[model samples]
Target: MTHAPMADPPTTPAQTAARVLLGSAMVLAGTSHLTVARDDFQAQVPVWLPLNKDFVVLASGVVEIGLGAALLALPRERRTVGWVLAAFYVAIFPGNISQYLSHQSAFGLDTDQKRLVRLFFQPVLVLWALWSTGAWPRRRG
Candidate 1:
């Protein structure tokens, strides 16, 4: 007996909502990176890096804003933007590690556990970025 081919999974409303939310969040966050919390970002840069905090902050802000805008603006470029955003996440990972190592206070949490918790979300953010881009592989019949 021949087996029947399986149908592609349907996109659920929830999934669509998630994509929209995630995309919106990225846009808002990227905008913030460009403006509102610009100084906060500069302070987050690891002191060990041999660069002025202002330059680093401005450069990173531009990248974040640009990537964020691209993700929102161009649907076709979603995959490319997702990869770039993922790279950005990975690139800044050391700053998170350094924050935890230094036991630096953030969001009013002094303990390393709080910082550790924040570090744990980095990968999640990366995944969200990828998902938002809708770049995951699909099975073909």
Candidate 2:
């Protein structure tokens, strides 16, 4: 009986660059939450929510910064980071829905059309998080 040879582990300069670039982008984006559009971000918090708008914005900025830091700091944690980031995206989805449903404008996204555009972009951001962490791999059968 003959056994098939094992496949080599995947490694490419492009993959390395992709990982680094993606991680850097997340880190930068998360940091931006601290300052850029700060008021608009605070305003996005649901009015019925118990927390103060400033607190919400600050808390979310911290979380994003932490998550982004993790993605950049640990190589082994990339996959886990991807999953966590995906969950993060899922968690914040309601904010987007709320904005759309309420006809609310924030961060210069005025008009239903622009808000709808944001709705469409959210999933892409999620996918980008996934892709950044090398969550997707080509399957061979």
After superposition on all C-alphas, the RMSD of every candidate to the true structure, in Å, is 7.1, 5.6
Which TM-score value belongs to model 2? Answer: 0.79
* lDDT tens per residue, model 2, 4-27: 754334435665566677667766
- Residues 15-108, candidate 1, lDDT per residue (tens digit)? 4455566667766766766677666665467879999877777787677767766765765566666778888999989878877876666445
TM-score to native of every candidate shown: 0.76, 0.79
Q: How close is candidate 1 to the true structure, as a TM-score?
A: 0.76
Error of 1 at 130 (Å): 1.0
Best by lDDT: 2
The segments of candidate 1 whose C-alpha lies over 4 angstroms from its true place after superposition are 1-20, 34-36, 139-141
- Evaluated at residue 97, the lDDT of candidate 2 is 76
Top TM-score: which candidate number? Answer: 2
